[model samples]
Target: MERWKKRNWGWKFADHLSELYVVALLLGVAGASFAAALPLASRWYPPQYQGLAMGIAGAGNSGTVLTTLFANRIAQHYGDWHIVFGLALIPVLVTFILFSILAKDSLNQPAPQKFIHYMNVLKQRDAWLFCIFYSVTFGGFVGMSSYLTIFFNAQYGLDPVRAADFTTICVIAGSFFRPVGGWLADKFGGIRMLIMLYSVVAIMMALLSSLPSLTIATSLLFVAMMSLGMGNGSVFQLVPQRFQKEIGVVTGIVGAAGGLGGYFLPKILGNIKLATGSFTFGFLILSGIAILCMLLITIVQRQWRRTWIGASGKARAEHV
Candidate 1:
């Protein structure tokens, strides 16, 4: 690592473009990873046994806050983080130098991708089908992460630190549940898992809203997070299976939709709590959305099965 940077340290100005893309991907991974965990780090916690559990979860999610707050000052003195950053730059800087130092931009015209091809992909109803269903899971994971701390503090009557701790528990369950969700989907079909998880989430949220006890509410919301995380994995798995030909475009579009849903869930919760002095209505609305997603996925799954079955029947007839 030290030897490589020393060898390529004198990179020129034309080298910045390729290196910049590496830096951008670095920032994307950092932002997405941190966004996945931030709100959990900012909430409050319960007492005794609950506190201990929340503390462990909070510590994992709190990496983002810890890095943001302390890494700079520590690095300013010790320089460990910078050493890693310098190491990351080695490939980016070297590649740009080797390519640009000798090669010219080719004169041959590059073929353009057709807008109609992307439009044709967009027109496929199955594409929108996954978008709707996955939005619940993706939205729930990202949204709940954003509002989990605030929602717990407000709904469950914990102070900021305690709320953060409970939210951390939710975050922990959701993050870990992602892998478990994928495993479950693999064993049982993804569509089946999505239906199961979304149903559980809707039911849990409704139950959470009505619970007067903080302990009960916290427990139910934790369950909701688990379901939401599983639903996210299920939705993506379904997306790839259903839209195998256009997985990349469908993934990007559906992923963005899910993120958009996450962005809105918190704001709506805040408004509902403020306007009505109750979270029951808010929970009920989200439950409705989840139910709708479940229904949509179920319908899509049926249609897909029928289409495949019909095609197989025609093939068998031809053979006979």
Candidate 2:
């Protein structure tokens, strides 16, 4: 009887969302799951493994690759976008069942803090800094993921299928490299890794602003997305170290800022294109933000080493 009910809900849930606005609402709700993931990962893993644990979980963003690669083709083939939503229920149901069976709660869960405590957390400078850093890194990664297909279609005259293929290749790099970023941060230091990653993004975005050839543009975007993905991992690596007890609230705030950044980036680019007849200013502005973040990190690392993580940005032995 329980199994039958689950199947019935799944079928109706996917089949009934006929409106695009409803789909967008559902997607927003689903995306909020990312905020829950890192805190759970931090609770389950030791400080030394925080980055890797969060990165592995965060790599779920790669689900975007599946959508980019298949959704359009599926819609075109069926001549109806609604069927794509219905087919999506298969993976959603599978994940739900697997999580229900396999997931475990960590024993070291922290006591819940009061509302005032959370509000005070917002007063801390570090929390805002993390929010800003994530806004740029995760923001750039998702923004580009959402917009690249359109950019390719408009700029290079590629058909929807070909443009989506290009976007998938870029998204794949960002999605998979997230874990690598965390591993590197664990081995070296999150701060150091992010510094290098931001430099890469700054350079790549600047080059891309030139409106290079199709091959050159794709190569640049691939590199930029990889850096942004890694930067996302690196930022989270530092967050738990700096605010272990407040991980849940802090992660939610930072994650929301990243989402806002993602929302604005495409709008900025689109508006720039309309106003100036080119994407040059938008890319240049993004590049400038990267440079600013790099400089900010360099200045802050000195104080950070003294106050929290060691000189190398690794979690202190006692903290771990």
Candidate 3:
């Protein structure tokens, strides 16, 4: 359907509504693919190295940088930017074939979970904790990626191209640090790493809310993005541990919450801008939420240390 929409002959039938509907369908598939991949990584890797594995998988986000940087150039060069979409289909098809042929289920896979199992999983307090943590971390990263360019243009008076360049820098920093964050979580601990990451994010957001000078603000954003990226890695490091038996469903639910957080962030920024005539309030509110998440993490860290982390000492020793 998407391929047809991109073809010249089918362009006549591909109105705006049809294009949007196709996009919605594509996004659904993309979300499901991400949710599935999380559990696969957890299953394939040992407990201690799960964070590193998940971090590598999550780093696929770097594709955002490639598309943002090149999509426009491809469109301008081709005289029909939608041609890029058509070209993208080739890679998608190739990857699909490659994945189908090469991917294998883990030998130690758990029994397939039922829908009721997922409902019961959702009832667990830790599931909701992980969801909120991911919602803020992944949510903040994606939300900033979506809005940073606009913020630069509107707040700092940067031209569109320069704004995009700045955004790219922040995104690259964030994407590249994800695996490092995971490795650190493996060495240090996911919860401890996240507490620090959240504190840094909260501080950076607070500074950004003050609308500092361009250089300072850009630096803050870059640091915040990097921290948020790490926070994302750190959260996933703990997810598989907390929901070892139900990682798949918990991943899907937490991932969905993260997406919802991303969606709400832009709305919050836009609404706050309209209501109070600046983005300061929105940033402050987000900062507050980060702090709140930190407090929640602090509250739960004790039980987690006793139950999960303490029990996993043998696994960590094996990795060593």
> What C-alpha lDDT do the candidate models reach, one value each?
0.59, 0.89, 0.81
**Which of 2 and 3 is ahead in TM-score?**
2
Clashes of each: 11, 0, 0
Clashing pairs in 2: none
lDDT of 2: 0.89
TM-score-sorted candidate list, best first: 2, 3, 1
Of the candidates shown, which would achieve the greatest lDDT relative to the real structure? 2
> How many angstroms is residue 250 displaced in model 3 relative to the true structure, after the best TM-score fit?
1.1
Put down candidate 2 lDDT per residue, 9-46, tens digits, no spaces.
42244434454456677788888878787798889999
Task: Estimate the Cα RMSD of every predicted model relative to the unseen true structure.
Answer: 13.8, 4.6, 3.4
45-157 in candidate 3: lDDT tens per residue?
A: 88888778889988878776866566666767777755767776786789899999988878877998778977898778888888898889888888888888889889989
Q: Could you estimate the TM-score for every candidate?
A: 0.63, 0.93, 0.90
What tens digits encode model 1's per-residue C-alpha lDDT throughout 127-168? 777667756776777677768667767766776556666667
Q: Worst 10-residue stretch by lDDT in candidate 3? A: 311-320
Off by over 4 Å in 1: 1-115, 308-320
Q: What is the lDDT of residue 250 in candidate 2?
A: 89
Candidate 1 residue 241 Cα shift, in angstroms, is 1.8
